[model samples]
Target: MTRVAVIARILPVLAILVWSLQGVSRAENALTLDLSDYELTFEEDFDRLDVSAWGPGTRWIAHTPWNGDFGDAAFADPRPGFPFTVKDGVLAIEARKDEGGKWASGLLASVDGAGRGFSQRYGYFEMRAKFPKGEGTWPAFWLIGLDRLTHTSEVDVVEHYGHFPGRYTASVHVWDRKTASKSSSVHHRVLVAPGSLYDDYNTFGAKIDADWIIFYFNRQEVWRQSTPEHHKQPMYLLVDLGVGAGWPTENTPDPSVMLVDYVKVWARED
Candidate 1:
């Protein structure tokens, strides 16, 4: 077992009181999540980047298991404080231009090439983070369903593009292998005042159940959708500071840093 798995097994479970929503309207009535009914399944506090190119014991891999690296900046391999670094219990995924002027950044996935690592079928996943601001910075925390042999299912917990400082996006997608098309997809925009996200840390979360996929920002419901059929399989985690999600990178800060305080997951009790 990986060190993270061992740590989770030994840690004590704690109760957390999150939001409670009564209806579809977030403002109508507030509700609370009785976290006592759940068990902590995964936790990464970024004491250090416990990552590798491909791993047998590490908690993260430097690239996607399928090698599908997106965005304008390349997801470079883990090195000494270039694309990724840890200090004061926080992880900084950096997007920067090298001496040669080529853009490179960092991405970390919970699974490796062989599909070996952490994954869950249904759970609550969350990340506390502060994003970098500029014209081309693209920071995101997302999940990919593991049944890659047939089709692809994705849930974008939060995708923040720096050009649009006033809002961010979330999406759920299902792609068909046979038709080579996205058979189902939906997107939502969560609005905030400009420069707010870059100024402080905020929590992004998703609750995945058999029937629904609910999104939360700072512990409050922001958006939700019916669980896609393709998303019934297990899903894994990924976080990255990418440059240019179809946006211009010329004005992107020379060294943009996305700080993550923690990434965690909790499985429901039966």
Candidate 2:
């Protein structure tokens, strides 16, 4: 074969190879984080509300199993019917009033009232949820120490107050032995658009490591900070729709619902 003939034959093959490489590069760049860096540890789609590998009965307890309630609203027992339901592959936590006009909402904790369930030291946690929109309603996907909040090491991945619409709060707090009744915290009030959280589902994520805690919204990092030394223990998850953190729920509407699509956690593949 002539030299020119050989060159022409090889050139098209080289071009095709180059085009294929470029396509792969674009796909990697579009991903928020290389998921290959971690191993799946926990996940919940709420499709059946209880039928996942890291779930069903292995991960979440489905109920808070506690006594009293906190915040501006009353927390109802995380039971089968009233405030909690699984329908159309989604978990709905509804906030409503009873016949006497008293407020009630749902709260689910990974651990039971006796403080026993799944807990992780450090990992990446994420959730897809649609917030309930109405005055005085507060919906959140958060985590606390497996030992409970008395120690005060709580990581608020996404907390949406209905009064504010599209704004969500992400915060990390440590209140251990050294706190002396005080606390150290890093918090951010993230704003998107007015009532945006109600319009569609959004993914909220947090990567917790030894030195840092990074927060993400819609798979994009939004805020981060150095990890506090006091947060050195394992933590469990919580999802709830409350009437207020400390404010009154008198203005809250009777029928408010927060829809959850899935929750996932991954441990770094170190």
Candidate 3:
């Protein structure tokens, strides 16, 4: 009986030691970034379609070479064909081909004469959306800085085309004026679940801190870039659906929809 008791006590000690070792192993391999510690600094209430909420640095402009209303304002076309609409509390940016044999639709950015509308220096930006799918359709949710503010710091958080179904691309472009050469800039690609984006709404986000930038798809880390040089500035958010771009080859024939659920921004609550 005494031996039995000794064995039981030693067994517990051995089990605890094993648990401790497992915890250390996980801590070494696990990569974590918790944004819950931050507070909401800005948000857009799409209830009434207010462009003023976007602030002074943004100017709403139609996509170049194509004249179509892109904002959620009264100036937008009342009957803009299929797939693009503001119904059920969502902004649907659809890509459709007109009678002119060209994909005529969507929005772009224009802050001022120099094209410096909405932009920031450094923070956490995110959007919840579902991309459109079809051969020749190009959909994107990303950000571009003003020429005066960033010089050439374009952060593409999520850009994908139906032609390349199921694979999303993310890149960071720093112009030659900003960096010694274009090749010196950092870029990375991530493989997303096949048909996951257009299947439903997923959260696409990017965290730009003082040292590194991390990209996330549906709360999962996909890519990271360690560019301490360009991490100190803020950037704005842009969500649009484009078509006939060089990547998609302009082969899509039917109208497709890019639905955006919401956009939210956060910063460390100091």
Candidate 4:
């Protein structure tokens, strides 16, 4: 009976070991990629915002100067001919008085056909940033999916205008190809103060699970949306310091600043 007792104990231990190994194997099979271990996936300490590493994904397609543009005019202030500078580890997309006698300094995303590549399905996305505070400066940290070379599905994780202090906006855009227009569904949430985004750095993130996209400000959930049909495609990230669009037009003018510390992506560890 001593031998029988030993066998019973050994069988349970072996069975538990096998079960644990199976669990680990399933986790390994589910992981596609993980950016947490990568140190150089992002460029840092920029003395000047470089566009070389960026691809056909970076270009100026349309601006306030473009007619019939759906973007906000208050935020459309691209300095007519000059470009913004990134120096001393800070990116300053400035608005100054040019010889053209127009106050211009605006932000632009990766052009339709150039710049950063694209991501399709679900992943973890995040950005650390401090926005500018003047009456009309609008800043945004967001993402858009390049659907076979067209801007069809866009997601705005955070969009803040100077006029709306202590609050950030989130939205999703669905393009109507036939009508040449886009349908936007959006939500606005107030951020915690003292920790307000305008004065200091804060981290914003979104975890796009299989069927749910949850928005977080400074790591706290502020909003969530469920759309299983569209959450499976990869999407690229975008960070822009826009001036006077959306809700910034309602306030006064002051030289605002948008400071981005870093953007990071991550995945679940098995």
RMSD (CA, Å), each prediction: 10.2, 18.6, 17.5, 18.3
lDDT score of residue 199 within candidate 4: 67
As for TM-score, the candidate ahead, 1 or 2, is 1
Worst 10 residues of 1 by lDDT: 1-10
Best-performing candidate as measured by TM-score: 1
- Stretches of candidate 4 exceeding 4 Å from the true structure: 1-48, 52-83, 101-103, 106-120, 148-151, 179-184, 246-254, 268-270
- Cα lDDT tens digits for candidate 3, 138-175: 66766655442334455778777567675766766554
* Clashing pairs for predicted structure model 1, backbone only: 19-31, 20-30, 20-31, 20-32, 21-31
The residue ranges of model 1 lying beyond 4 angstroms of the native Cα positions read 1-34
Ranking of candidates on TM-score, top first: 1, 2, 3, 4
Give the range where candidate 2 is weakest over 10 consecutive residues by summed lDDT.
18-27
Q: What are the TM-scores, per candidate, against the unseen true structure?
A: 0.87, 0.79, 0.71, 0.66
Residue 14, model 2: lDDT of 18
Residue-level lDDT tens digits of model 4 in 1-270: 001122234333211111111111111112233346433333334454434222343333223111222223223423333335555676655544346544444444433343334343566677887777676666776666655333345567777656667566666554433333232344445445622676678877777767777767666666667643444576666666655453435353544457777666665553
Which 10-residue window in model 4 sums to the lowest lDDT? 17-26
Off by over 4 Å in 3: 1-33, 51-84, 108-118, 147-150, 177-185, 228-231, 248-250
Model 3, residue 213: C-alpha shift (Å): 0.7
Q: Which ten residues in a row have the lowest lDDT in candidate 3?
A: 17-26
Residues 1-270, candidate 1, lDDT per residue (tens digit)? 111122234334321212223222331133434468899999999887799877768999988888866777888988887788899999999988888998999999999988899999989999999999899988999999989777778888988889889888777776554553334557777777678789999988899988999888787777878898889889999998888776788899989999999999999988
Residues 167-205, model 2: lDDT tens digits: 777877654433333544455777677877999998888
| Alpha-carbon deviation at 25 in model 1, angstroms | 9.9
> lDDT at 168 for candidate 2?
74
